[model samples]
Target: MILWGRPSSVNVQKVLWALSESAVPFDHHIVGGKYGGTDTATFKVMTPVPRVPVLQDGDLTLWESHAILRHLAGGVPPLADQWMEYTTSTLQPAFLQMFYELVRTAPADRTKDAEALKATFLAAVAPLEWQLRKTQWLGGDSFGMADIAAGAMMVRACDLCDPLSPQVARWYEQLQTRPAYRAVVMTSYEELRA
Candidate 1:
């Protein structure tokens, strides 16, 4: 298997975290963003849409981070899939806005954008905090693909936002205990920091 994307990408990190948790072996080639091989003819042939975190497994080439995670997990957990959807559809937009404003934009230019997105970001995560109060993991007691999807953002959320809800903080601490989470999702992404 060959995974193509930069490690610092949240989408790519989700796939990497899932692969590590599943103990799947694959070669990773840095592409997209600063690494910049995503525009090549070969890359374009593999994925016409041109996105990060393209997975090549034998004859099967998969794009979209969540789909790749589902494939790696063998089958999708319904609850987990729901949470993953919420993460991508609900939480990610606000989070990405704040992330770009704070981490990618210069400080002098960031305040207004960051301030605008802050409330939206908090609202998006509020449900996760409520959900975590009922279960240890997003899918239930055991960690699942949902954690890989949502937890990938928690790192940046912590760095880019104010204090998190207690439930979210506790759940994040639990996620940190997993070796795969630490190895893949928690690594320092200096290149991505502005």
Candidate 2:
């Protein structure tokens, strides 16, 4: 299997974390963000959108990070899938807005967008605080794809935002202790930091 995407990408990191958790080994080729190979004809043929984290397993080529994670997990856990979707659909937009505004934008230019995104970011993460109060992991008792998806975003959120709700902070700390999360998702992204 060949995985194409930069390690620093949250979407790519989700796939890498899932692969590590599942004990699946594959060759990874940096192909997006600063690495910049997604525009090639071969890459275009493999994925119409030319997005990061394209997975090639024999004749099957898969795009979309969550779908790749689900495939790697063999069968989707219903609750895991729900949290995965929720991460992308609910949490990611606000997270991305704030992340880019604070980490990618110049500090002098950050306040307006950061202020605008703060309420939405807080609202989006509220569910995770509530959910973590009951379960050790988002998918329930064990770490799974849902954690991969939401955990990736949560790591970035915790890094760039203020104090997280108690349960959410505890949950994020637990995720950080995982070897896979540290290796794949929590590595320094110096180039991405403002």
Candidate 3:
């Protein structure tokens, strides 16, 4: 299997992190966003929407970060599967909205549009925070795909925003300890820095 996308992208990051956690071995091709070396003709055929994080496994081509995540989690635990859907369908939109505002708008404009977006994210994040307070991981106890989905976004938010909730901070710290999470993020960070 092969995955394509710039790792810095939250969507891309989610997929990469999940791949790292899975037992499967795959190649990661850095493309899209700033890397800018993707083959448009081939990419367009694979993904009609022209999004990042496209996965190719033999004859199967998959797009959308969340969908790719689900595909990767095929035989994983039930909680992992359930929370992956929940976070992708429910939590990620608000997070993405806030990210779009922050990255696309100027600081001055951030006050009006981005602040509203951020506030919406804060509201969205609260329930997850409450849920985490009760469970060690999003998928019950063990680290699984659901935790990868939520953790990918949670780590990105923590990077951009100051003073994340205590529960979130601890969770993020735990994620750092995971070799898979560290490998994906650090590899991406190093390549981006280069």
Candidate 4:
């Protein structure tokens, strides 16, 4: 199997963390963000949209970060898939709004209301903060794709927003202890700072 994307991407980080947890070995090539390889004809054929984190496993070619994640897990866990979808639909958009305004946009070029962005993000993740209180992991009994999905956003949001919630902070700290999270998700995203 092979994966292509810049590691700083939250979506890419999800796939990398999942691969690390599953102990699956594969080649990785940095192919987006500042690295600039997404336009190549070879890449165009690999994915319908030019984007980071495309995966090729034998004859199977997968696009979309969560789809790659589901394939990695063999089959989706019910609760896990539910939350992962939540991340894609709700949490992720909220995260990107804040992240792009705060991190990816140069200060002078930033026009969005930072306080509003933060407020929206915190509100969108309120359910996740509540969920972590009931279960140690989002995927019910064990940490799985659901955690990988939302957790990636949670980790990035740590430095940007005031505080998501107390439970979120605690979960962030616990995730820091994981080597995979540290290596993939916690790596400096300075390259992404505008």
Candidate closest to the true structure, highest TM-score: 4
lDDT by residue (tens digit), candidate 4, 63-85: 99999999999988898899999
lDDT of each: 0.87, 0.85, 0.74, 0.88
lDDT of 1 by residue, 124-192 (tens): 999998889899899988889998888898887887776379998898899899998888887776787
Instruction: For model 3, state the Cα shift of residue 87 in Å.
Output: 2.2
Report the C-alpha lDDT of model 3 over 1-194, residue by residue, as the tens digit: 98888878777888888877765798888888667756578778888776698999999999987788778877657766777777777678887776666665555665556567777777777766776788887777766777778777765566556426877677778989989788776443323321
RMSD of each: 1.4, 1.6, 3.3, 1.1
TM-score of each: 0.94, 0.93, 0.82, 0.96
Give model 4's TM-score versus the native structure.
Answer: 0.96
For model 3, the superposed segments whose C-alpha errors exceed 4 Å read 37-39, 75-78, 108-114, 186-194
Give per-residue CA lDDT, model 2, range 62-171, as digits (tens). 99998898888887778878888899898988888888888888887766656668778999989987788888888888888888888887677767776388888888
Model 3, CA-based lDDT: 0.74
Count of residue pairs whose backbone atoms collide, per candidate: 0, 0, 0, 0
Q: Candidate 1: which stretches are off by over 4 Å?
A: none
**Residue 115 deviation, candidate 4, in Å?**
0.3
lDDT of prediction 4: 0.88
Candidate 2 displacement at residue 43 in angstroms: 0.5
Ten residues in sequence with the least summed lDDT for candidate 2: 154-163
lDDT, residue 177, candidate 4: 88
Pick out the ten consecutive residues of candidate 4 with the lowest summed lDDT: 162-171
